[model samples]
Target: MSLSVARRTVTTPILLGLLLVAFALLALVVGSKPFNQTIIDIFLKVIFVVGLWVFIGNSGVISFGHTAFACLGGYIAAWTTIKPMLKGTAMPGLPDWLMGMEIPFWASAVLAAGWAALWALIFGAVLMRLSGIAASIATFAMLAMVNSIYSNWESVTAATSSVVGIPIVRSIWPYLIAALIAVFAAWAYGISRHGLALRAARDEPTAAAASGIDIPRARLIAFVISGAIMGMGGALYAHSIGIVTPDTFYLGLAFITLSMLVVGGMGSLSGAVLGVLILSSLIQILRWLEAGIEIGTTTFALPGGVQEIALGAVMILILMFRPAGIMGNRDLSLPRGAASDSQGQTGPKT
Candidate 1:
């Protein structure tokens, strides 16, 4: 590599190390209330981003429908936790085993993730056939289709109304543990053979197929894993809020997650994590702005369209400048830099 490129390679890890430390600090101290929820929120963000990274980062695909798996998980854990005997408007069709089952929080959470994987297994068959823009459109349509069901399927989920009574057990510690697991899982997938296959297909679909790789299978595997992770995340989210509604499953979430991925760097998992941290905090900042717009005595109407405007601006800027993403395809740990020659002579810029 040339001197300039060598300098960049050396500097990258140093910068990432500093940023990781900063994120850790921020996670520990983002809230003013001091209830220690900021740390938990950080963990939740980590889980959500890592889950999204598994599919979009590895396969170079966008899925606008993952919220459904999250919904699936939320309902599963909610049903498992709420008293089946009382049967408040949770899911009317909740399994007989769940009714009065009274499983532990951890178990219920695992099952919620498993159920999410199962849902992906069934749905992926239809969705994986398409790729690029077509896949994105179909997956988005799938989300709309699922949203219709969730909005109306009250007997199974109390319809559009919210359900409560889910015990709130998740806190900073639980979030920490979950985040660690998520990070490890995401890292493992990045290097695993499945990941390799997916990457191969993503970079060169025709070549990968010629080598006997099944593009759809690789995408489906990633999809199932992504859905499972989202399920766990949803269960955690539901438990955190102690209640849920159909509104939680659609609209803002998928976009927020997608924004996180793109802003951080669609090509990088570390990008996804950074994207979440940045965007989550941005929401708080926007809310703060809205508050600032309000008068001390009377409320001033906060301006509309701020978030969409901001996110769109950021996405466009990133696309223009750092097209690979904030971190490119690298991370704070385990960065895979572009190759260099034995003498470290830099090639011409691509």
Candidate 2:
């Protein structure tokens, strides 16, 4: 890359990091305990959305299966971090080694991520062979299979019942750090040769293959990387709520995360982060309104579930006007010139 391009590349991630830290600090200062929880939720969502972007944004493949990785990660945390007595009783079928082990949360998170990535590699090896809608369907099927197994595995997973006793980390600093790590990781991959090649294939597969890019390998790499991220997010999410269940990482979450990614602009890292922050802020506001917030002693309240309806309508309107997303694949860049693009300029360049 040229010096200017390289500088832009480095500066983009730095700007994003600063933005996230600023938000973290703002929440710490201004938010009460409940509000802080909301902030933590947003940070976790940031990780999940960015994880999705790593593959879907670059490879142009939509995956409904990523949540399986999250479910795996959450269970890993449950198996590794929960008290041995509770784990043994709740999941008696677990092997002695797994049933007896109770490690620190951080270590379990790492192991969870590694476990998720392993499965991603195995599944991606097979699923990455297919393309377009076939790949999408295969991924959805994989998700269904995982959900079925987790939901029915009563001995180990406790079936659909909630597993409790996860160590809660309510502090925002750890979550903030994880969110920053995810952003940097995504930025690093996006500018890597593999990421570039993958995007090229996404736009023009035949040309990229003609140029000797191994599309399947590139997709698999992205898939594994994204799975690791989703796994980490899941582990943190389990700790955040102090519980785990199959439904926690199922279709409802998949739709919500995918919507945030799509509504923000799936083609860019900024979109991934911004989508979560923006949509999360809207949801928090709606929740407050639903709880009857008072302004000048006149309480205002929205009906239950109006938040989802309103959010859906807003997403529809945004897609209608800006189908590409609010950012539309543009990187967050510092202003350097009066004009950046000349596609629709009516007069001569300044």
Candidate 3:
């Protein structure tokens, strides 16, 4: 790479790191709840949004069913930390092997993500084979399928009611570490040749195939990787909530995740993180506005839907003005000639 591109690769991450630290500290300080818990929540959100960017943002394949992966992760992870004898507290059916098979927090987490990735492999194969509206339709269908399974599969997760006593413990430190790993994983992938090929395939499938790239393989790989990451995020969220239900994943969460990616800049990792922070804060502000706060001389009176309305307006405005996203496919602003020597020049400039 040239000096300028090289500099950006080095310095841009440093700046992002600083920003993460700043935001994390801010998260740690917010609300009356323990700072650690709040920080953990934000960090998990970071993981979810950033992980989604790996596929949805880069490959330009919008998925509306990622919540399935999240739900799978949460349910499986619940099995690890939850003591089976808790009876109704654990998932029903309780296969004899799982009835007493409670593992450590992290181990269960790994298994949960593995299961999610396996599902992604199967579903992503079919979905990745499609394009544009067809692919989107398949993904939406996947979400519906996953939702039905989660809701009706009582044998495993306690039916439609609560899956209780998950024994989830949330803290700032673990999530902070997870967030760092997630960001680095996304950055490394984006900077690699495989990612380059995927992006190429996304922009022009016929040309990419003519150039010997296996478009399906690239999309599948990206899909699996992204699903696994989202699973990890779900595990974290499950542990945070201590208990959950299938309904948890179906309440507009998929839309929220997609919106975050769109608002943040579907083209770049920073945009993913930025979009989450901006939108999450917006929600908090709206909540505070709707519930009049005691501020010395004034009380704010905002409508209840202010948060939703504001987010919707912002999303519309962003899409209308810069459809590519805030970063517009630029990972980071390059300094002069950073990429002096780069591969895949034949690929369209992103």
Candidate 4:
């Protein structure tokens, strides 16, 4: 890597890390329990969005199926971490080994991520063969298949019923660490040779192939890496809420995550993280308004569900005004007089 690139690799994450820590501390000190949970939710969203950035941003392939990995991870965490007695009572059909074993939440999370990545590797091996809309459709199909199975396989997944008794983790520290780990991992990958090669394929597939870039292989690697992160986030999510349901990782989540990525500038890691932060902050603010604000003799409140409406309108406006997103595919870095690199027409500007 060039010196500038090396500096960015170190500085970019430091900058984003400071931002995340600042907000985390602010939420801890200034917010109530519910508000703190909101912060945790935002941190998890960061993990999810950054995971999406690793694959979608780098490979230039929109994946509608990543949430399936999250679903898998969430259930795995639930299955492995919940008390053995509870598991036996709640999911009697589980294999004897699974029903008899329970591990700490952290270990379960790691296992969950591993399981999810294994599936990603298996699925990506097949799905990565196609490109453009074909690839996207295949991924969506994969998502539908997973969702349908999870929604109906009552024996293991509890089907549409929410699986309860997954330990609730109300602390912010674990989520903070997970989010930072995801950010740094993304940064490391974005600057790696494989990440650069994948972006090259994304921008100019024919030229990239001519130059001997293994497009599908590079994409599969990214897919697996991103899937691991998504799995971690999903595991964390289940712990946060103390429940796992098939619908929890379905279209609504997919839409919200994709919107954050698209609105933040899908081509940049900074955009991915910032997009979640900015949009989540907006949603929180609108929700607060919906809850009602008082001024002297009057109480003001937005109509119910107005937060979603306003958020959608705001996203549309932002897209209209700045199509590349708030960050516009640029890496976050300190200004170096006469030494800075130009933002290029590619994802992960390494």
Task: Give per-model TM-scores.
Answer: 0.82, 0.94, 0.90, 0.96
Give the candidate number with the greatest lDDT: 4
Candidate 4 to truth, TM: 0.96
Q: What's the residue-level lDDT of 22 in candidate 4?
A: 90
Model 2: per-residue Cα lDDT over 1-350, one tens digit each = 24454555666667778888888888878868898899899999999999999999999899988999999999999999999999888999999999889888888879988999999999999999999999999999988998999999999999999999999999999989999999989887887777878888898899989999999999999999999999999999999999999999999889899999999888788888888989999999999889997789798899899999989997999899999788777767767764232111111345
lDDT of 2 at 12: 65
Please write out the lDDT profile of model 3 over residues 93-154, one tens digit for every residue: 77767777878777776787788899999988888888888887788898888888878877
Q: Lowest-scoring 10 consecutive residues by lDDT in candidate 3?
A: 339-348
Tell me which of candidates 1 and 3 scores higher on TM-score. Answer: 3
Decreasing TM-score order of the candidates: 4, 2, 3, 1
Clashes of each: 9, 0, 4, 0
Candidate 3, residue 123: Cα displacement in angstroms equals 1.2
Q: Candidate 3 vs candidate 4: which has greater lDDT? A: 4
Model 4: CA > 4 A from native? 1-4, 342-350
lDDT of each: 0.74, 0.88, 0.75, 0.88
Top TM-score prediction, candidate number: 4
For model 4, how does the per-residue alpha-carbon lDDT over 1-350 read when each residue is reduced to its tens digit?
45667565577778889999998998878869998999999999999999999999999899998999998899988898889888876787899899877888788878988999999999999999999999999989998999999999888888898889999998899999999999999988887888889989999999999999999999999999999999999999999999989999999888899999988988788899899999999999998899999998999998998988888897898889999888876768877764344122354345
Mark the regions of model 2 whose C-alpha exceeds 4 Å error after superposition.
Answer: 1-4, 338-350
